[model samples]
Target: MSVIYGLLTISILVALVFLIVFIFSVKSGQYDDSYTPSVRMLFDDELVKDDSKKSSTQEQKQD
Candidate 1:
């Protein structure tokens, strides 16, 4: 009854606060890197060194 109205108003206020914060951040440049984040997973940070090639050469020398 009365409690429900209070809870609803509090929730709405909280939601509005979050929306305002998000809007301010967007305007400030927090989300400027819109493209790199989406494509970051497609590229590797560093090339993986091929250890097998080195190990095979070492084995040939030892034999």
Candidate 2:
């Protein structure tokens, strides 16, 4: 049917757009740090070390 042809054409166009976007992202370093994200949670506490230090100082002042 004509409707089926139209749907197929639209789907292919959408898929090609997504492919181009993905390729652009890859070339722009979007996936370069793949490992970091997977291990980022393990280092979340380290990222807030200054906050912990601030809390400790506050606790000392309270004492």
Candidate 3:
């Protein structure tokens, strides 16, 4: 019985801590980039292609 009470109290404290941290993160613009992440993958391939082109050009110049 006493052990159960202790466990319950600990769990509640842990939950409250997590809730507070989440609230702080929200207020601090942690989630502000809501759109970029979703669309970022769409542009990733283009970026990789551009990078490879630039590297190849640089290698040609060096050689």
Candidate 4:
């Protein structure tokens, strides 16, 4: 019984420490996507096609 209580206490402390570290990391933007958005925008196929279609339709309308 005492061993179980000790184990439960240690597990809870370890979990709390992990949670605190995760929150700190998030607050510090350690997991923020600084590069993915810029790179994703550069390589996104749908956006590129949509932009080309819009301009082509505009040019056709002008003609």
How does each model score on lDDT? 0.84, 0.94, 0.98, 0.96
Give the Cα error of residue 29 in candidate 2, in Å.
0.4
Model 4: per-residue Cα lDDT over 1-63, one tens digit each = 999999999999999999999999999999998888889977799888999999999999999
Q: List the residue pairs that clash in candidate 4.
A: none
Residue-level lDDT for 21 in candidate 1: 100
Which 10 consecutive positions of candidate 3 have the poorest summed lDDT?
Answer: 29-38
Question: Whole-model lDDT for model 3 versus the true structure?
Answer: 0.98
**Model 1, which residues run further than 4 Å from truth?**
34-63
**What residue pairs are clashing in model 3?**
none
Best-to-worst ranking by lDDT: 3, 4, 2, 1
Q: What digit string (tens of lDDT, one per residue) describes model 2 on residues 18-45?
A: 9999999999998787788889988889
Assess candidate 4 and give its TM-score to the true structure. 0.67
TM-score of each: 0.54, 0.53, 0.54, 0.67
Among all windows of ten consecutive residues in candidate 2, which has the lowest summed lDDT? Answer: 29-38
Candidate 1 lDDT, tens digit per residue, 1-63? Answer: 999999999999999999999999999999898898778766544323346667788999999
